[model samples]
Target: MDCKVKLWEVYGDRRCLNTFIDHSKAVRDIYVNTAGTRFLSAAYDRCLKLWDTETEQGKPGFTNRKAPYCVGFNPGEDKQNLFVAGTSGRKIVQ
Candidate 1:
């Protein structure tokens, strides 16, 4: 529960590639887009963030009163930019 998100290399050396230290609380969920250009992270800090895969820079996206539990990216090409976040408040937000 260090409130950090990590990226690891799948090939060769097999070491951590980067660490995202943005959340103030434990990160509960993460979703990566189909093309892997972006990702989303939901945390118990009651915040959701969007990140650039290559740059590792993140910006706040959603800040609900309730903590977010999960996140997912839209798979359809027509809605590729859309994503959803499910919160502990029992609501799913887009």
Candidate 2:
């Protein structure tokens, strides 16, 4: 079987928010947190942006990193909501 998919993001007027990202490396995957408070986007750009769903802006929590192919929050942990990012050569950011 073969499958195809299209992705898009609409914000505010749905027309004013027209920002395109060239993930030439590849946007391998995407994941959103359970609380819906934050979302993590992974790309070949070798970087990850933690977005604030409520304000539609980047969160200041996690910063200073290189391009990441995958990212997610640590499951079954508390006190510190740390993110785990996957990069090339079997590297992980915690």
Candidate 3:
């Protein structure tokens, strides 16, 4: 894997819009917030990253002892800043 995250515009013309290359390993999962303004990614590099959709910029936000397998953001409007992740170690982190 090239270790890149690509964003696409699906409705109009259906084309790639941006590419984010921050994780050192293959991205395992991605979660986009409900408003579509931000996203989170989990990677084999044992880290979770947060990205700003508009700016096309991202960075590692949390590191796990085991590789992160999946990630998601809280759906509650009042808890949008919260998130959770599952790791290879069979543990969940919030």
State how far residue 45 of model 2 sits from its true place (Å): 0.9
Instruction: Give the clash count for model 2.
Output: 5
- Write the residue-wise lDDT of candidate 2 on 1-94 in tens digits: 1111123356655543323243344555566677756667666556566766566666443433456767887665462267788777578877
Clashing residue pairs for model 2:
46-66, 46-67, 46-68, 47-67, 47-68
For model 1, what is the error of residue 64's alpha carbon versus the real structure, in angstroms, after optimal superposition? 0.3
Tens digit per residue, CA lDDT, model 1, 1-94: 7798899999999999999888889899999898887899999989999999798899766799999899998889678789988889999998
> How well is each residue in 1-94 modelled by candidate 3, as lDDT tens digits?
6588898889989998999888888999999999999999988888899999988887656888999888999999879899999889999999
Off by over 4 Å in 3: none
Collision pairs in model 3: none
TM-score of 2: 0.59
lDDT of 2 at 83: 78
Candidate 2 residue 74 Cα shift, in angstroms, is 1.4
Worst 10 residues of 3 by lDDT: 55-64
**Model 1 stretches astray by more than 4 angstroms:** none
TM-score list, all predictions: 0.93, 0.59, 0.93
